[model samples]
Target: MIEKVKGILAGLAFRLIALLTLGQISPILSACVIIERDGKILLIDRSDGLGYTIPGGIVHYSETVEQCVLREAREETGYDVLLTGFVGVYSSLKRDPRFRAVALAYQGQIVGGTEHGSGEGSTCWQAPGDVFGHMAFDCESMLKDYLSEHQRFS
Candidate 1:
């Protein structure tokens, strides 16, 4: 399928770039969108079975972080979203097993499109409190940070 080929090519390209940089390249930049509706958050059950996490991925070379989050949300969750505001930035050496990454998290709202799962796995809305224990990656921490800030405003 085209998606599989794209994934392969992307992995190759990423590895090639990492090699070219002699590993001196800065951490890869990524963006994630926090989509909440009715007090439930949108989450993806990653295909690799790494558990649930927010919809996001690496930022493409031609796109801004905002554009990347929007695109990722649409691609992975089948939902078109509008970025409302930034939540925070997260970076840690051990955050991602593949490599160091710096992710910009933004709050968003669904504006169009329908919710569905892609090859990434199933998509669902879950209570914010229920998601932390089931999360993968640094999602638990990210959500905590976002929720704490959100509470202050609410």
Candidate 2:
């Protein structure tokens, strides 16, 4: 309800701005946080039938990538997380269906807050293997890369 309204408003605003710029906008920049606890990872089922994905969203004009990831995590999953490290950047043009988007992926630890679902989806914690082959967007690749890197250090 509220999320849908926000999305509609944002779409209108973007369209208006695009008209002003003659539709010369670049790919959107977003951030996603990979929160891990006890060998499990947090995922959200994006009610749109897009399946599970890392908790994340577009980085607002006034916010940095770090701030975006933390804010998105809290908003979507009801968790307060502290970023532990950056995983990597995902910028494939085909990664998103609506538009080209570049996502900054980060690794974080849940420091506080209870888990809950947002208008966008329900939240759950799953083992990395369970999530690996069943994520939406390019999240599977991102998760695998992050896990592989972490395993090397562990």
Could you say which candidate leads in lDDT? 2
What is the C-alpha lDDT profile of model 1 across 8-115, one tens digit per residue?
A: 576577668889989777778988988888889999977666788899989999999888999999999999999998888788777766556788888889999988
Clash counts per candidate, in order, are 0, 0
Q: How high is the CA lDDT of each candidate model?
A: 0.82, 0.83
Q: Pick the candidate with the highest TM-score.
A: 1
lDDT tens digits, residue span 19-57, model 2:
898988876899898888788889997776667899999
Residue 20's lDDT in candidate 1:
95
After the best TM-score superposition of candidate 1, give how far the Cα of residue 26 lies from its true spot, in angstroms: 1.5
Query: Which parts of model 2 are misplaced by more than 4 Å?
Result: 1-23, 150-154
So what's the TM-score on candidate 2? Answer: 0.82
Weakest 10 consecutive residues, lDDT, candidate 2?
145-154
List clashing residue pairs in candidate 1. Answer: none
